[model samples]
Target: MIARWTSTILAAACLLAAPVLAADLRPGTAGEGNFRVNVAASGGPSELPDRIGPVSRIKDIATLLTARDNQLIGYGLVIGLQGSGDGLRNSPFTEQSIRAMLQNLGIAMEGGQARAKNVAAVIVTANLPPFVQSGARIDVSVSSLGDASSLQGGTLVMTPLRAPDGEIYAVAQGPVFVSGFSVQGQAETLTKGVPTSGRIPSGAIVERQVDARFNDDTVLTMQLRNPDFSTTIRVTDTINAYTQSRFGKRTAAEQDSRTILINRPTEVSAARFVAELENLLVETDTPARVVVDERTGTIVIGQDVKISQVAVSHGQLTVRITEQPQIVQPAPFSDGVTAEEPSTTIDAQQAGGQVAMLEGPDLQTLVSGLNRIGVKPDGIIAILQGIKSAGALQAELVLQ
Candidate 1:
């Protein structure tokens, strides 16, 4: 058919094009092609376009140096565990907390021992975000500190959350909501997720305000989450270009690969300048990198990765050995006894093996070379490592 003849001609052209492409690859020069490295899954490669990636807003890539979160922690008690709570005798702290709470409420606990099984000691934690004012409700996490089985259906008593300076900044008290459960029988026990950990939404209300004023400073520093020389240069250029257009002068200075200092205009407040600065768009750059996790057989390739022309031959050889036991009977009249015999067999096979010429100037050709070999993920990995060893891979190979 015409279609078959066309396919044959195309294959022949591809085979004949290798030497011409390889000749163009001079000494110590990368091949010519545009590529972006992103494979969605094993054996099912996602298509990479010829162009670079999209630009992103500055806010998505960088953060202000002064804006941060503070941690708050406190010790507390949980009530109503339905007999799955800690035993007061084993956890003396739980008994002590109960007695102190009773004393605070003007109810005296006599000298007798409290044998309550429904109370457990716990640690409560929450994050105080930057600029969070008083009366703002934040979420809190509760974790058991005693030998309690579960925290399901328990109510946390009023606990004061303190900062590192030992000052109470918030008060947390709420009904715990657990995502898992546990059940025990006479013979066996089964548990889903850890029932001792739970979280409360809007469980803590701030009482003290952190003295933070964002607009007070005339200048601010912006820090990048991932420090890179190329990305830092690009960000600085973008900011300067924007400032020149608006004020006829540049106000941003690049301190290093990670930090940048910007002077807010005297007419504009710090908040307004930061709002405009963070919305500027910049094209990011990344080094060519190939990361492989051998345990999970995962490979992540960067956009700028390239390969050189190389010849590769890969195949899978499988050998199987099986054993069988046989019984032997004695002859009709002789004084011989029955005996057992051992039998063994082996099978060896090689399938889907091929010798292919890989011409790499771009990710498409590289993947096309792999497809010609009919290889799987493991074979792909081995071939990549082999190419790296031969100096045919243009990117850095990292094994993790």
Candidate 2:
């Protein structure tokens, strides 16, 4: 699975490289015959955040930036286990929990001594999102709530998952689907991944919906994840321009870096009005940023990233050590016994490379110069840091 995921990511990277290169090469800022003018713009308050729009008709930017899911969790039990459940003797909670569940069903166990080998205590979790109506199904994740060895081929009982408000929002129940398997013998046991946790697709039904209202009064606010003044101004102006042209009146205002307020029309419903506002086109001006993922050796640079004249020199130092053993014998049976002798040797060397010079009048030229010098992600990070130190790079460098 790890290999498959890595391969998929690499394939996506290859496919995205061309478009990303093209976007990086394009010019920023609004002007006739420029890339900025060719890009779509949205109808919202001008002076809002630049991250707000692509100004396209497909509504792709809004969808990409919004989240629509909530986490739901509950404690429950898995019954009908085939000797793979938690040992009730060691896990007393499993026995006590089962007794409580049975008592709820009108089955009385007098002394809390219910020996059940076919049941295992489990925790159930699911995602309950906004707009989810009653009876809508969602996937549920089941994990052993006790000391169970495995949950393979077990059935989870009905469990009510609740939100932070202490209200039951979903009910999960179904056959647990374990992704991996396990085998046990008298002398040996082998397991893969996690045997105590599993998932059930479409195993939970929503019982309630979360309230997420975007319009309740005359003002509607649009928020940006990353707050920037330039981006906010562009967003505000684009919205004002688009709305004034389309509706023959100004209806939006840029409140701050993060929020934009739009006037709600009396003739249109709040939902419909917000929907139309979301669909309006606008061009966005992204801030200059360079993000580097050190662990994965990945570097991402924004289109606005710029660098000045700089020189970079990188060299790797490598050390090598060798050990050789020698056996010593008694010479001519003299009062000596066989022994062993050890020797060690060490050597150091530096990698062969020439100091590279980077000259940049723009972002594209900077990237081209860096790439031409065969600088990998790690090398690029060091070079960028050096440039920033020298007051040459005009962007924020974020390391992750």
Cα lDDT tens digits for candidate 1, 1-400? 3233222111111011112332221121111122212111111211332336669899999988756776778788899889978888788888887877776666778986788888888888888887888999999999998899999999988777767655567878899999999999999999999899999999999887777656665567788887866677677767877877887766666667787666666688777888999999877767788888888888787767788878888878999999998999999999999999999999999875667888767667766777788887778889899999999899999999
Tens digit of per-residue lDDT, candidate 2, span 73-118: 7777888778888888888877777776666666779965777677
lDDT, model 1, position 159 = 79
lDDT of 1 at 260: 68
Please give the lDDT score at residue 289 for candidate 2.
90
Q: Give candidate 2's error at residue 202 in angstroms.
A: 3.0
Candidates' RMSD to native: 20.9, 13.4
TM-score of each: 0.73, 0.73
lDDT for position 321 in model 2: 97
* Number of clashing residue pairs, candidate 2: 21
